[model samples]
Target: MSVTTRVYVARLAGTAVFDPIGDQVGRVRDVVVLVRAKGAPRAVGLVVEVPGRRRVFLPLTRVTSIDQGQVISTGLVNMRRFEQRAMETLVLGELLDRTVRFVDGSGEAVVEDVSMARQRTGDWLVDQLFVRRRPQRVTTLSLRRRGATLTVPVEAVTGLAATTRTQGAARLLEAYEDLRPADLADVLHELGESRRLEVATALDNERLADVLEELPTDDQVEILSGLDRDRAADVLEAMQPDDAADLLHELSDEQTAQLLELMEPEEARDVRRLLEYEDYTAGGLMTTEPVILGPETTIATALAQIRRQDLPPALASMVFVCRPPLETPTGRFLGVAHFQRLLREPPHASVGSILDSDTEPLTPDATLGRVTRLLAAYNLLALPVLDAEKRLLGAVSVDDVLDHILPEDWRESHDERLDEEASRG
Candidate 1:
């Protein structure tokens, strides 16, 4: 097969890799490139995920052809895992979706893709970028419209260097948009600390908060510490009160106080309340935000509230029926209504009529063991936590119970297992 003169690196993602005799080797995951100080970066190798999910480097020199949907390589291929060097950059992971300014004063644009060309010397060098202009506001009409996309020489734009501090993760996030928060956290955990911080910095507070909840405590603290104080506080406010409190417990008193002071008073108050409880108690595990409804609320209203896209599945599993004041610390906790039961009843029926008042609620000081047993015995997704006056305070989801009962180093152990499996292969 004749080698193509130029190819867009992003298009190579998931392209099959085969040996000279046509045996499949792996699939392309990313392109490794050595960034230069004053010019285009030189292509280093392909990061290929082979059998056993092990990522190994395939040097461009070993590649015989780069055709549509496939790459042909020399039979000799190293099986060792790929480890990125300090001077290396991942084209798909780090470069794409970055905002850059054009050298000719044509306004800012976002990097959509990059193209590398084989030179006369047989070296592959990144020489062009496919970019879309940033959306501009039309002051006259008070409207905004997306700009056109154009292919420009790499030298025509700036901020492509690996050292660029202002790099954004727009393109990178698009590539991983389908990933769940937990899976995205795993990807973030595998990145170098600096790159991970960069990506975190680029994410909006809400998105970062969701990802932080899924990360290990140390990682959560590290990423939070890297953000600006105000931004960090905003992220905390975006997280569930229980999760925010758990992360704050891992930080120093001074640091936690400073962040709390930066947060909105209403949001900080909920977290402060959770922080007052012991780590393994129901209070510490319960989220201050749950579907709390008044007795008079129609089943239609309750269903509409839980059907919100923002509500987590566990929290949405049931509705806590209470008296006046539907917020936490709600008046006279009435009972609970399972989601399935709501679906079976008429939409106009009141939640108060179909309550499961028999099931007992957990007090804040209830032991973790008791909470776990109740969740199992009732087969409940969430259990309400109440105060001495029987006022609804929060609800402990089954996920919170599992997080506490699991080994402290479970996340680390999961990573180790992946490495062990790769080593065996």
Candidate 2:
């Protein structure tokens, strides 16, 4: 239960897979970590099985020790999987290290991570789990850091823990299992601010970016306040410019000035540009991170660079031909083409050939009404914003526009409003 102590110890990776070990058996299917809790983190436990492989269960009992990041099962399962399947029922911390599945009265999903909770009598229960994607929401939660496009319920999970190893390369990938931004937002709301700071400080930068994007503006401010100005700036800096500006707009000017001063000058200038736009307009709302190209660059070279840099989903979909300025693009715009079109069409084809000249881009100062209409008419997720000389300024995604205009609770509360209007009519 010690926050700083090693919950589970392992050698392969820096930390343990499960705190109490006995329940991890049958080649550990998963380790579920409930990352949405707003209070002290609350997690669950699970295990998975295939056609010939029978599942194992790690009850709250049997797990006695946690070291590093792996659970030590002194109960029935022993420590790690050793190609043994002889059924041995245990009594005490007897479940220690034994592979076990949760009989949730429902079926089992993969377990992701395990956490310890004290019961009324001061005994610990192996209570929390981080599961894999057998449930759809778990997949969305898992990709939170990857910037996937789907929104998950964060509510389908009922049962999970850290008794099993996750897939390759995602060693610490337990938290996002079935986690929802709204649920995480609620947890941030519940943590009474201080705890929120504590958790955010401990998370990695990429994780902080994901969680910050999910949090309400108020929680975002509180968490930022707890961090050193540089670290806070770093978190915001990692965000897409538009998303970072969304949070900055919520802060006092004094706070805003302090945060901007703390950021890298180039990054600060880019974010500042977006901030100067009206809070809801396309110019104000577009991501400055575009897939820009110099007039002299070849389609082949542009394609290579595009594959290398992480692109905004919009620009990746629509390749804009222009020169790169400090943070913005320059030169007269040559319109853009779908990247796929460029690839399928030919490598030697000039960007001029691929350009879709008919779709007129908006200026950075374009109104939301104009931007929204453009999105609808073009049936596009995003559009390029041009400056006075028809230079590519930035691009706005439809998702960004919706976020700028809608209430955060729109998803949860929209249904009730519809019902009320029906009743009124």
Compare the candidates by TM-score and give the number of the best one.
1
Q: Against the hidden true structure, what lDDT does model 2 obtain?
A: 0.55
Worst 10 residues of 1 by lDDT: 416-425
Compose the digit string of candidate 1's lDDT tens values, residues 1-425: 47899999877777889998899999887898988878888997888867755567899988899987899998667776676787888887888877888999878888889999999888999999999887555564433556799999989988788445666677777666666677568667767787789888878888899999999888899999999899999999999899999999999999999999999999999999999999899998999999999889999999999999889899999899999888889999999999999999999999999999988899999999999999999888999999999999999999999999998767545344444444211
Any residue pairs clashing in model 1, and if so which?
A: 97-171
Q: In model 1, which regions exceed 4 Å deviation?
A: 1-6, 11-29, 33-88, 97-112, 116-162, 415-425
List clash counts for every candidate, in order.
1, 73
State the displacement of the C-alpha of residue 237, model 2, in Å, after optimal TM-score superposition.
1.6
**Candidate that scores best on lDDT:** 1
Counting only residues 3 or more apart in sequence or on different chains, how many pairs clash (N, Cα, C under 3 Å) in candidate 2? 73
